[model samples]
Target chain A: MAAGEGHRLHRLGLVVNMVGGLRNLIFPLIAIAFGTSTLDFGYLLLVGIAILFIGFTLFFSWLAWTRFRYIIGVEEIRIESGILNRNARSIPFERIQDVSIEQKLIPRLLGLGEVKFETGGGEGDEGTLAYVSTEEGERLRELVRDRKEGAVATPAPEIANNDDGTADIRRFEPEAEPLFAMDTQRIFTFGLFEFSLVIFAVLFGVAQQFEFILPFNLYDIGAWIGIVEDSGIDIDAISWGARIFGAMAALASLIAIGIATGLLRTFLREYGFRLDRTPKGFRRRRGLTTLTDVVMPAHRVQAAIVQTGFFRRRWGWHALKFVSLAQDSKEEGSHVVAPFAQRPEIDPIMKEAAITPETLDIGFRRLDWRWWFDQWALLLPFALLPIVGLLIFTDVGARAALILLLPVIAALFVWLSWRHCKKALDENQLYFREGWWSPKLTIAPQVKIQSIEISQGPIARLRGLAEMEFGIAGGALSIGGIPVGEANAIRQRLLDEIVKVDFADVNRG
Target chain B: MTDCAGFTPTAPLAIEEMDVNYKGFGAINCLVSAIQQRHISNMDEATETEELTRLHPDHVKVTRIVASLFMLVLIIPAIIAETAAYLNQESGPPNGVFIIPVLLIAAFFVLFMPWRRYIHRGFHMSADRIRIVRGYLFRSDTIVPFGRIQHIDVDQGPIQRRYDLATLTVHTAGNHNSTVSLPGLLHEDAIAMREEIRAHIKRDAI
Candidate 1:
């Protein structure tokens, strides 16, 4: 790593610490809102700030003081570093479940990569090595994996001749070779689209943040101008030139805000971005200050979720999330490799990760029946809420207020929900694919399932519909809107198959 | 989880099946609670010895008859109140007068239906395994090979004590949905069932 780059990284960390520490100062306000005593809230904030300060100081000092050294031995990669307390991490070869790499525009320009290590345990069990070059990261990963998998070996071959040497032939070990390399074109296409979307999202976020800062309602200005005429504020009495200038001023302000928002987003989202593969796992390191490194392992991942939002679908950009242990849900604890991955890039990555045509993508069954059942079941809440609203309004003018509100909201919800109940299942897995805007497909392996159950309510029974629930180590995801018999049959088959497999790593050998 | 990589166990074709019924019990209970305002004051006794003892010696048929009669007596008034309210809502009094009665009838209908269903939904145990298929809306079939049974517990509620009966529950490693209760089982039968399940577990372990 270059000394200049290291200095920049240290400065970025200090900025992040200072910004994050600001949260502690506001903690007392939250504590008071929650009904804590003022004294207690003050004490809480004091302790919190102290902890934050100490933690940030130690982290920044360590980053500045230490020099990182790494090496690949047979079947393992060892990273040794520390200023005061020397630290060494040794990751074994077989345990190297995933090796992925990424580079952002800045990192691409700087030729740096962030490497992550995913241990597939409970929280706080994983580690990451960040801000190294992409080439070194890939080389280290290859060395460890080849050594572990007992693949072909070739000692280092010198790419350059040294100034004073006869022949500067570098010896490369057998283990130090990359098993996979990404296509540059696909990566570039993906990065370009993702970079744009992130800029848009950040701008939107900033606009919402500045919503309260505006003193007047710019949205109501046109209507207000008409009102001014009605209220006898003689707009015709004012000069025509002044009116034109006022309108132009408003337009300029709006444009200026938009431009500022866009610029702020671009800088924040793209700062210090890089994605890369390490010896232990796939790594995504991003953010200038408060740098984040996400490491994901292959074996520990229980499911893969592919998401495509409305705009992304048109551009063929998508995101992938890995469902793993103790995450509460598939959406949580995910390592986002890219904010946007183009279809060409996505397809190959999926193929390499064993999540493509041969595996997860095969034999998916769309759950049309769930949509129908959900529509019917929705009637319960439809009936219940209206009745409650009527009852409440009858006495306290709640009805008048609710009647003016509830129908439109409820109707909109029902319409949107109807569009979102679609699902797909296959012989080996079930895809509970739903959502109108943010579509998510949850893939569950049959072997990991704990039980399968089918149930019906009185309304569902009348409709001849049943709900099928697939229970796994996590929790149950129920599919509604299938015929009772069909759901039962599917449930039975799943259970039968589940009982047949040995899930606790007993049969993998 | 240890691997015997090349080994695979044969799937069972079929096992001998036994019909067990606490017949119409769960459904009856569900309906009785719904339609009848007459709340059960003796549930503890009903679930214990009184209910269990009915399956033994000579009182099995007698107890069933007595329980049916009790439910009928409790439901008749609720039916009358609701029918009267529905038919004569205008002439005699407002429907509000019959609200309690209507609620009682609804309660009885809800309770007895499910109770009778539960009674009808008993486990069919054989020498090899136990199978349970349940749910009025979402039906599920749970198969527990007796060999896989880790332990068995014979539970007697206050009512079961009065009837001298017991409910048998089987536990296993994959025991997410493993409840096979012989609600009206005689004490001796419950003990025998427990022993049988325990023996299977022991054999499977060996």
Candidate 2:
């Protein structure tokens, strides 16, 4: 298996990973050397264990380099390797779920890439293949993908034609070049907002930490503020002056940080972002350093989430991620059609991916406003505390605390509901729109739903609300908390749809 | 009480014995009540029966309730009391030890008999599909077609080992809750049912 540029790149990765592990272990060892306690020593020991494991891995990897042999067969892909413990794995063409090709900076430089095969593992385990040359990975991906499609072709096309006569069947075809590529201009535009926020936060945090460095010292400002005529100087004015200067300095620093961070993240994430419509589904590739290629099976996509923020919405910029059968360790895993795309950019991908609002039966039974009202019940009492306390004390400190607490409480209440008060469903696919600061939209296929539950609490009952739980098969795809009426309607609808449909005829029905 | 035995499928099939309705305990009623408490309201009050049917189809729910009640009334109290006593730190008259044992034995007549009489039922498969209608408190009727069967698996466990019994798991594709595990069947009976379902699938395929 270790033959060509891909082999050299894999070896380099092994070396880099080993060094990284060692560096992390050295930090704790250094701390222990500086008179840290037994707990610290224990931590260091754990780190050493990891380092040792990695070391042993390097040794075994070398052994495998000699023993390994993989045959990308016509109907099956087989990997045979191991020194002391020999093992061989062979997966037939029909069972292959997805085949992907990826290339990172090193792989790009070396003209090599990695290929991964996803199989129908239940929940925890998926399939993977780590390293291959770019050309080899592409070749393997094409062969496996084509074989799987060819196996299922006769039935799928016939079913598709029966279901929707006008079905625009798109076959899986590998592209020589990427479907979408991020230009320098687009990257810069994407960076602006991120860069600004990062810069602002860093500046504000630094200013808060070393606030004493300001020209107007708190004590000096207080002395200047002679509030009681004979008591003290006008410190309030002095403090205000200092605060203004600090704010200006912070703002300037924020701008610089924002730009740099924004550029870096944008450049790295969408360096060569691509989304291609394949026969079975969509294949996505992005990244500069550690490139990732995700080939998603349309049948496995339980949900499609489109997210946009206030700024993003205004600019028509959004991101879409597909919720599929990925394991817990890969919870954030999704087939991203594009990173930071505008509405127009996302349109073609959505259409090609066969994710449309009309075809997908999304339930819109929103959680009643009462859901938000219940939160205020808990919120109002906690918020009233400082105000009640202030009424008794009437002191300056008490007054300020009371004054500050109101807006803070109000903000908390707003943010809490703003983020959590979600709209979700159990459709032919489950679709949801959630999140406050960084809002997201998600859609999932129904067959992937692990379980369905209907629940109602006393408070919710009084308000005529109920919650439905739809457990997606893979990790983190499961979403809950649709309204009572909506939950039931969705449940009923899903039962009507999912229960009666012949799974073998899923493509048709 | 409703039992699966009483269930008469609309189609033609063998009926070795039918248990259509559960007799006394209102197991479905209790479950429905419990389920009702967790949600704000039933999605459709008019179709509470339908919802129950969807939640757990009639035949399967009845068999489960009947079998579970037997365990609940006869076995659970003993297990619970013994477990509580074993787990309890103190020896006392009203605490885990004393209360639990009394509760276990008392449960046999007090809770067991009544519940056993109230709940417990089974279903019979007819031509076309299976019909299961059994519930004590909240009545439910479920009908499933044989053609809808995506896959089927037979399972045997240690407990079933003692009784020389097994369970049949039926799955329908696209339905998360497609599995209907039919238990409390004799080993031979289960094999026959498996063959029946297999034949049904084969017949429907064309």
Top model number, DockQ = 2
TM-score of every model?
A: 0.44, 0.51
- TM-scores of chain A in all candidate models: 0.47, 0.54
DockQ of 2: 0.07
Candidate 1 runs further than 4 Å off: A1-279, A327-333, A351-353, A357-427, A472-476, A506-509, B1-117, B120-206
- Tens digits of per-residue lDDT, candidate 1, B1-206, equal 11110000000000001113433355543453342212122111111110101133222333444455566665677667767777865675445554576555655555444343343243446655555544443344445555333334555544455666655665432313423334556767876876665445333322
Clashes of each: 74, 55
Q: Provide DockQ values for all models, in the order shown.
A: 0.05, 0.07
In the range A1-509, model 2's lDDT, one tens digit per residue, is 34531222245445544554566677656765554445646667666666676778677666666555666655555555556443334444544556766666655666656666654334322234555666667777778767755655445342265355655543343455545667778777777756546555677688778878865543454544444345654444568778799789998776776678888888887776777655655677777898987777666555566877767777888877665555223646555666688767776666555566423344344445556667566677766786667766776664466465675666675656545545544345556666666667666555444445454455655555545555443434323334445544555466555544333333321
Where does candidate 2 stray beyond 4 Å? A1-121, A124-178, A195-247, A278-281, A297-300, A326-333, A357-365, A375-431, A443-452, A458-464, A471-486, A499-501, A504-509, B1-156, B163-206
